[model samples]
Target: MAATGTYTETFVELIRRASAELPAEVAEALRTGREAEQRGGLASIALNTILENVDLAREASAPICQDTGTPVVWVHHPTGVSTRAVKADFEAAVREATARTYLRPNAVNTLTGANTGDGSGRGIPFMHFEEWDEPRIEVRMILKGGGSENVGAQYKLPDGKLGAGRDLDGVRRAVLDAVVQAQGKGCAPGVLGVCIGGDRVSAFEASKRQLLRPLADTNPMPELAALEERILREGNELGIGPMGFGGSTTLLGVKIGVLDRLPACYFVTISYMCWAARKAGVSIGEGGELTWLS
Candidate 1:
């Protein structure tokens, strides 16, 4: 379970790429959303500024957003690999990335009210490890900002207030309600990752996991796919256009995931991601070769 210098450096590069560059599919979605907005409208202007910022960040090899957000990492590795070693290397890389200015020092001490200057705290860079049959190590990361994270919502089904039941319709209602509540606050023109069924904690985890999917991917389940489309269509129709400016481009994409729930609990969770939506992945071969995956 020893960390190698090469692995640590490669992880640093991975963090750099994820922090500085927006994924192509997400950028394309933003472009398409911009084009759909009225020419001289606020939505168009906001998207235009966003696109320019994306380009500037890439060109300068800098963090995409001022609040670099929390680095949430998922590691998939071969059975023989050591998860503890991987986590140690990842933590090292996160600190180095922070020092290099690719990430801001956002981690703070709750009781002391002090900033963890190196982005290392109790659970600053959250990591999850999974062992697979693959011979190589695959690391994927997403930088989730506090603003969007604050807007994430979880709802229990059979709620009388929203009239949501333990069904797909209920899920839809909950999602729309989240969007309405988050109008322009989660840095609008955002993406929604939803989980239909699970316990409270697992449902939120599954919802955030859905955000790792590509923006252009279609859900394997037909019903979920249709619901995704419906939410996207109806969300934009609310006139909560880019930054809630009243335009055609409210949401760029919607991803849904489902999990088994207990008989008594039907929880629906929604994770909202801002336009930045920064994520990246890398696969490290046994020979130390690296392959970039977006």
Candidate 2:
């Protein structure tokens, strides 16, 4: 299907929704975490404030967080769709979103230390496009903030320092280490998206893709599912608490994905997502009809 002029407007709305609202599953996780904390403690207070922000952002049609991190999008289009045209629409939508304040001007020139102002620098909205058999175009996006991005970590296994071997246990150790190091810095009560066994770049990409999964969904792989649960349970016990205030609500959820790696490389990448967890999706029909996928 050919791209239409309406595609850009549809994408702008998608960006607005993603930036202004937290996903239902993520918000539910935060609610559950808040209930688990001491009612009058600092952790509770932090969670309460976060929830308030969520509500206010939605009500005001404003961004959930001031730092509307990078826009990372995944697009699944029909076999004959033109990726270049789709990308052009995405770029236009990003500029429109920035102008409307749904997204902040975040794209920066790495070497020059200058902001792009329109959120349209090179690779500004990092996107991945895949051809699918489906008739409609499906798009999923995540607005990942700078704080959480800063706390993301990658580890090479069989390391003596962490006593981490190239195994599931090593993966567990690396994820927990990332959490401890982040403390409250990644805007705790965070969620983790972990990828095991990919090369350095693919590892990080796969890990961030895991963040697009719903918080309540189970990993199809039995072992990975078990690890996710174990990590979530143990992570909350570390007393990192909400926003690093010291409590039992450190992480809201954990999602894990895996990729094949070379024998010499066993890389584990963890992408930390702050509680805002701004994610949204849409399906565009051939006639430009829109369906929100949340």
Best by lDDT: 2
True-structure Cα RMSD, model 2: 1.7
Task: Tell me how far the alpha carbon of residue 17 in candidate 1 is from the true structure, in angstroms, after superposition.
Answer: 1.1
What 10-residue stretch in candidate 1 is worst by lDDT? 1-10
- Could you report the Cα RMSD, in angstroms, for every candidate shown? 1.2, 1.7
Error of 1 at 245 (Å): 1.9
**Candidate 2 lDDT, 178-269, residue by residue in tens:** 99999999999898999999898898889999998888888999999999999999999899999899999899889999999998999989
lDDT of each: 0.89, 0.91
Model 2, CA-based lDDT: 0.91
Model 2 scores a TM of 0.97
